[model samples]
Target: MSSTPTDARLMDGSGLARRLVEETAARAADLTRRTGTPPCLATVLVGEDPASVTYVRMKRARCEKAGIRSRHVELPATTTTAEVVATLEGLSNDPEVHGILLQHPVGPGIDERAAFEAIAPEKDVDGVTFSSFATMSFGLPGFVSCTPGGIMRLLDAYGVDPAGKRAVVVGRSAILGKPAGMMLLARNATVTYCHSHTADLSAAVREADILVAAVGRPRFIKGEDIKPGAVVVDAGYNPGNVGDVDFDTAVTRAGLITPVPGGVGPMTIAVLLAQTVDAAERQLA
Candidate 1:
C-alpha cells in the first residue's frame, strides 16, 4: 500500500526574525534619540562552550547593528553558582543595564537553574526567572522565553490561530517546552503537556492539531506520529542543527513545519533584542 502524501506548509522563522530585528533596530534608534541612552543588554557567560560563545557573539553583533549597547561578562569555567548569582545580582542592581541574559549550560559542576534564578525578574529578558515563568504561564504581560516567543510570532505570521485547537508540547523544560505550552494555552489552545514520562507519546502527538517538538532528542518524534494537517514547531538545536521532528517525514504529515537552524534559533535572538529594548523602555518609564 502506498503512504499518504504529505501536505505540509513551511514556517520560515529566519525571515520573520530578520524583519523583527529590523523593527527592533528602528525602535532602539528612536529610543536613543529620545532618551539619549540606547538600550543595553548585559550578557553573562559562565563557561567557554564554543557554541555558547558563538551564540553570544551573534547576539552582541546584532545588538551593535540595532544601535544597542552590550556589556559582556565572561566568567571562567570554574565559576560557582554563588559567584554567578552574585554577578547577576550586581547587574540587576545596575540602572544602566536594562537586560540580563545568563547563557545556559554553564559547566558540569554548575547549577544552571540556580544561576538562572539569580537574574532579577525585571532584567530577565531571556525569561528564565521564576517570575517570568509565572507571568508567562498566567498569560500576563512579561518578557517571554525567546524561542517560545519566536514560535508564537511565527504562528501569528502564518495565520494559525490557536484558539480552540488541540496543541501538544512534547517537552517540559523551563526555558522551552514548558513555556511553549503556556504560550499556546494563552492563545486559547487546549494544550497537552507531554514529556519523557508520557506513556503513549505517539498517541498524544497524533491527537495534536498543533504539535511542538522540543524534546531535544534529534528525530525523536517520527513523522508517522504527527497528525495530518497539524502545525509543527521544531525548536530543537541538536548537533548538526537538526530538529527533534524528522523534517523530511514530518513535513509530509504536518500542515506547517519549521525548519531546524533557520527556524526557532534565529527567532530566539531576535526576541531577546526586542525584549532588551522593551526592558529599557520600562526602566525609563
Candidate 2:
C-alpha cells in the first residue's frame, strides 16, 4: 500500500541568512563610513578541536563577506582554565574588538563558564554571558545567543507566532535549547523543556505544537512522534549533515520543517554578524 504524502513546507534558512547578511554588510559599510572604524568580531578558541576550528573558520569567512573585520586567537591544547580566561579578558578589553566570541568546550581542564564570563557584557556578541541571558529572558533589548536568535528569526520569517502554542524544546544546552525556550516563553508560548533524562520523551514531544529538536543526536527524534501539522525546528547538526529529526518521515507529518545543512547553520552565523554590527553601533552611540 502507498502512503499519502503530506503537504509540509520547508523553511529556507539559507535564503533568509543571505538577506540578513546583505543587510548586515550594508550596516557595516555605513558604520565604517561614519566612524572610520569597521565593526570587528574577535574569536577565541582553546585547543584544536576540529569542530571548534571549523566554526571559527566559517565565522571568519562570513565576517569578511559581510564587510566585518575579524581577529582570531587559537590557544594550545594544554592551555589552562586561567590562561583561557585571561585571553578572553584581554579580548574583552581591546578597543578595536567590538564583539568577542570565546568558542566553548575548551581543553578538558578548562572551565567553560569561567571563560564565557570573562567577556564583557557589552561585547558579548555570542550571548554566552549571564548578562545577556538575563536580558534575553526578560525580553529586554540586548544580545542573544546566536543560534536561538536565528531560530526566532526563522519563526518570524514564516509568520509562526509562539503565543499560546505548546512549544517543546528538546535539549537544554545553555546557548541553543535553554535560550530558545526562554525566548518562546517571553512570547507567551507554553514552553516545556526535555532533555536526555526526560521520562516518556516521545509523549512530551507528541504534545508539542511547535517542536525544537536540539539534542545533537542524529535522527534522535522519530518522525512518528511529531504531532501532526506541528512546526518542527531541527537544531541538531550531527556528522554527515544530519539533524535530530528524521526529515524523511517528519516532512510527511509536520506543517513546516527546517532542512539540515541549509537550515539553522547559516542562520547561526548570520545572527552572529548581525549582533556584531549591533555591538559596534551601540559602542559608538
Compared with the true structure, all predictions reach lDDT values of 0.90, 0.93
Report the Cα lDDT for residue 274, model 1: 98
* Deviation of model 2 at 176, angstroms: 1.1
Query: Which segments of candidate 1 are over 4 A away from where they belong?
Result: 1-6
Which tens-of-lDDT digit does each residue in 1-285 have in candidate 1?
Answer: 124356566788889999999999999999999999999999999778999999899999999998889999999998888999899999999999999999887888888888888888889999998899998888788899998999999999999999999999999998999999998988899999999999989999999999888888998999999888889899887997688988878878788888886888889999999999999999977
Error of 1 at 285 (Å): 2.6
Model 1: how far residue 88 lies from native, Å: 0.5
Q: What's each prediction's clash count?
A: 1, 0
Per-prediction TM-score = 0.96, 0.97
Off by over 4 Å in 2: 1-5
Q: List the residue pairs that clash in candidate 2.
A: none
Q: Report how far off residue 32 is in candidate 1 (Å).
A: 0.3
Model 1, position 89: C-alpha lDDT score:
91
